[model samples]
Target chain A: MENVRVIARMDIKGPNLVKGIHLEGLRVLGKPEDFARYYYENGADELFYQDVVASLYERNSLHDIVSRTAKDSFIPLTVGGGIRSIDDIREVLRAGADKVCINTAAIRNPEFIRDAANKFGSSTIVVAIEAIRQPDGKYMAFVDNGREHTGVEVISWARRVEELGAGEIVITSVDREGTGKGYDIALTRSIARAVGVPVIAHGGPGKKEHFTDVLLEGKADAIAVASMIHYDLIAQQQSDMENRSEGNVSFLKSGRSSFGEIAPAGLIAIKQYLKESNIPCRN
Target chain B: MSGKKIAIIDYKLGNLFSVRQACVYLGYDAVVTSEKDEVMKADFAILPGVGAFGDAMNNLEKLDLISPIKDYIRAGRPFMGVCLGLQLLFTESDEFGSHKGLNLIEGTVKKFPPKKTNDEVLKVPQIEWNNIWERADRRWESTPLGSCRSGDYMYFVHSFFVQPQSPDVVLSVTTYGETTYCSSVLQGNLFACQFHPEKSGHHGVGIYKNWLTNYSNNK
Candidate 1:
């Protein structure tokens, strides 16, 4: 078994870091670089920056943000959003991302995944699958942050992406995203079982147990968190506002944690819980 | 970490930025360049990249860095290789149909078997933080891994691993799904690893610092 990775995922919308429930109703958080620096300092295994509104605009604006974050953070940074062609991927990578995750372009042309894997290495390519569980007991893939539904089955898509040369797959549940309900175990397990590549469970994770549950029960190799960790940062930012020197952290002072019941915990606390639960994690 | 002309060889592959960042963080002024003269003139050189072996070899050849890199190592100055850079030092690779490498180390880079001994399908590219343990005969006190504990975890993302012809040169090994392979090697001034020291967090950065310090002391 692989050591479980705790990745801090930041959903970016233009200049501010945003979050939403079920991938809708965007709410501003703060500057992504600020959160990125905090996460790296707190022991995040990896960092993911997703441009929430990039696909609609056909241009990724996270280049400046990614470059700024890369200047300080030493961990692997994955940038995803509006990536259409080889040039787009190259530009994002040259800016500082170690890996580029694609969804909209990959769904439009599946061969783009293959082309990317061949041009770069398979390890540099990650395919993000946005899935919504249907009433028929099936999961359907979605694009553009679950706004557009592609009729493609999530399980088959996961297998195809792996076969197409995706080194890793991040399966985000559109229904559970930002809801704090926990990860879709059935959805993540099915995808993890269907593919030979490492699968990262994303979307809902309200508590530390949710992480362990996804890794053990869902069979996920890693877990990507946005609301869970972001809320923790918000709490920290609020208490330390007096010492702050730069950036508008008023958004973080909102004291808004949509993740109900379970309190927000830092990366170290989460890793400590995983370690106590006998799940290997890099602290 | 002071005034050491560290050349981070750039062949249009991998994340040279993070490697340079890690070096700079350690207070060493490193340059990312493809020029042979710059690389040769550097006190220490690091070959770091992530991509196909064939393409990397082609790129190195195109940029005329193959000889300079080999000459730098031959001159006995400190040298390091990361990920594909480590693979490139081997004799050849089975990735994308058997491509010849720099042949500095006598080894063949081969992919992990599809199935483990338990008959379970093993995931390729093993993208995770796996623990690396020093060999029983090897003492890490003198190597770049001097600061690393025996079971310290390191970031890894690769499908293929190196099988050095001489086991004595193997410094560490990591087991993934029952497939144990050489993870790092130390042969005189040449040290390389399959894991990325730059992206491996604090412990990873510590390895670079140790390597630089070791080079400085020896000089």
Candidate 2:
């Protein structure tokens, strides 16, 4: 059985890691590097860093963060959000990212996917699509972090990217993003079933069953989570452990936490539970 | 490891930086270069490439690295070819169209035929971490994947696999659906695999370490 990749998606706003519902009302958690390190040290299979403002500002600001993580962590790193050109892709790859995820740039110029794939390789070029369900029950692909609709249906765009030479498709449901609700399995499955390349399900998954469901039933090759792990850890810490009395809820069980910051047991637990459900994982 | 210089051939076609970074982490003086002198001067040369075989061949020719790479391998110094690097080492490849390769290895690169198993179609460009087993005839014990158990999962992302003229050169094999093809091959100092060790987690770095230990220029 092929192993399902579990990736930690850290949305970066400048240097801070942030998350929001439906890509609005951003809240800063901490530095991108710290959160990246936390996920890397834990059982996360990969780290995906996307600059929330990259598309809006039209510039990539995650180079330093990608370089640091690439040099330090052994897991594969994917940097996305503002990549607009072949030179930008080269810059990120040379800086040490294993892959680059392109959304707006690729949608603007479909041939860019072929050019980048020809220059670098399809395996390193991932086409990211943000899909929001329409009132007619169809999924339309959105770009610029779900701010604008592209009018192209999600499934067709996924197939087009693969035909244009994208190695993978990362589909994020705009409706379920950062909502702590389960993933939009139908939308993910439709794209996954249509495209031949590996599909990464994102923008949902608040619980372990969500991972199993999307992977097994939805048939996604990987799952990218932000709020599920990041916010869950923050919520668990602040609500349950912060105000507890002595001899309770200490963060040093692993003795590896620095500055009282430690990766929660959530990811590992999800991995274990997934494996128990017969899904193979590296962890 | 510190003194041994491992030059990763950067033909502007693949993830050259990550390959070099893997070597640097193991304390190897790993450098990515296209200069003939730098490639010839290195203790070991790693040819890492991805994408089409014809495009890669064109890049090698454009960069004037063809002679130096062929000469490096002819000299019998330890050399390794990654994915498209491995494909480009064959006699020729039938990808997209007929294209000649470096012809160091006696094989032809081929695209995986559409395969199916248990009513589910297997996808091309098998992009995942799947198990690859070492062949018993020539144990990979002397190779980079030596410590890799029978079913050690390595990161693979490719649509084609090599079809060696002689199975004796094959170091390992992997199965995809109902098809089984050559995954990794070793002919003397020239070692090549279809997978990316740089993306294969810890065992991947360990493979790089093992390869460094097998070579002796630094010592």
Model 1 regions more than 4 Å off: A239-262
Residue-level lDDT of model 1, residues A1-283, one tens digit each, is 6678899999999999998998899888889999999999998999999999999888879999998998878789999999999999999988999999999899999999999998888899999999988899999999999999899999989989988999899999999998888999999999988999989999888888898889888999899988878888887767787476567766655555444654699999999999999998887
Give chain B TM-scores in order: 0.98, 0.95
Query: Over the stretch A66-160, how does candidate 2's per-residue lDDT look in tens digits?
Result: 88888867777889988989899989988889899999998899999999987788889999999999999999988999998787888888889
Which of the numbered candidates is closest to the native, going by highest TM-score? 1
Query: Least accurate stretch of 10 residues (summed lDDT) in model 1 chain A?
Result: A253-262
Docking quality of model 2: it rates as: medium
Q: Where's the lowest-lDDT run of ten residues in candidate 1 chain B?
A: B116-125
Instruction: Give the 10-residue window scoring lowest on summed lDDT in candidate 2 chain A.
Output: A254-263
